[model samples]
Target: MNFDKTELSDEELSRYSRQILLSDINYDGQLKLAQSHAVIFGLGGLGSPVSLYLAAAGVGKLTLVDFDSVDDSNLQRQIVHREANIGQAKVDSAKQNLQALNRHIQIATLNHSLDEAELLTLMESADIAIDCTDNFSSRFAINQACLQAKKPLVSGAAIRWEGQLTTYDFRQDNSPCYACLYKPGSHQELTCSQNGVLSPIVGMVGSMQSLEAVKALLGLPTLMGKLMILDGYTLQIRTLNLKKDTHCPVCQAQS
Candidate 1:
């Protein structure tokens, strides 16, 4: 579970030089990424690009969690999987591709579904959590776990021509958790399978999720406490403020 490298190699420096050059990142921020661990839930549409960009950005370790297998129908937006990976466990498929992307980073695959206890255990060591799952059940579970652990979370969703992004920096006292936005049972599962989707919309949201994760990892300013909505059809991006529900069950209990 601890695969952090002590230093970046010459090859890694060259691969990440463009980002390292940023005043916000510089060498210290890149080093922060090299020492961070991000646990990601699900390996479907949103997860695909989130994991890829995290690896390409040099996140030291990734814990990919999912129980489903790749299907022929997933190719449209699940960029991490291909025709060759059909029928393969999603976590396994994602691990294979992530390793291919960055051998220096460690990829850990959880091929089974996680119970609440299991999720809390896995998240204990994660610097951040990424929610890419398609259902409210998984999102609530991840939110609770991250809140308990005081870990940051980057969440993304996409359907049709719209994409949504949010971050919960649970380390902050006043930050809003997912439960602050949608309570349990308030959501009816609407999946891409039936709701329909545009491929690039999911990819765009996932990429933004990756960007948020990187910024969090580097201790830079991020979208925490804010919601970003992307209207791919109109090519418009909107940012909105969010307030924590003082009565939110999960967040209220944190105090």
Candidate 2:
């Protein structure tokens, strides 16, 4: 992607003036962000904030995948949709909201569950894949697809007052896949519907995921093999360095 500094018009300059103020993201960085594309799974709580922030930050293309529709319970954290959006596909609502947030961005909607085949197609065009789904099935599928595609996967989860963020860059050889941290179908887990989640916690984690995605796109250092855990009640954040499990099923198979 070629970036010409003079191509930014006065309107774009004013629009991204605040981002340009940051030394980390000047004209060059903004151009990189504008040229990059991301695929986000799930358009619920975590996905709502992730997509919103990414779109607002002027990512060139965003592809949203979700099989669900708007419900009354989603209004608390799914800020992309409203009361009128009930029964409407979440991806459709998210596309409309994202475009409204940034007209310069291109929005694509996939109103279907991400099976393995669809995952590969999405990752082919995406610079990064974000896992915001609440279930392990979808998360594991995303991880395997990212690993096969050699793409960076930014995964985030939030429940109640706790949130977690991690990056699995399979291109790095030793980075841990999502299955390395948690085995799929090995143990039972609760979903947001069963366990419930705090509204703001979803936003917090989703925003962090967006930040990591931007950093990865800009070639900035990020949490490639580390897990960040946030505690809303104590307001404490912990970073745990995770090593690639040589005996792990997924990573071992890949090796």
The most accurate candidate by lDDT is: 1
Number of the predicted model whose TM-score against the real structure is largest: 1
Q: How much is 15 displaced in model 1, in angstroms?
A: 1.4
Q: Clashing residue pairs, candidate 2? A: none
The list of candidate 1 runs beyond 4 A from truth reads 1-4
Model 1 lDDT tens row, 96-134: 888888998888889887999998988888899999999
Tell me the spans in candidate 2 whose CA falls farther than 4 Å from its real position. 1-6
Point out the worst 10-residue segment of candidate 2 by lDDT: 1-10
Query: All models: lDDT?
Result: 0.90, 0.86
Question: Counting only residues 3 or more apart in sequence or on different chains, how many pairs clash (N, Cα, C under 3 Å) in candidate 1?
Answer: 0
User: Candidate 2's residue-wise lDDT over 40-141, tens digit each?
Assistant: 998999898889899988788898989898999999899878888888899988888778788887888888776789788779777898999988888888
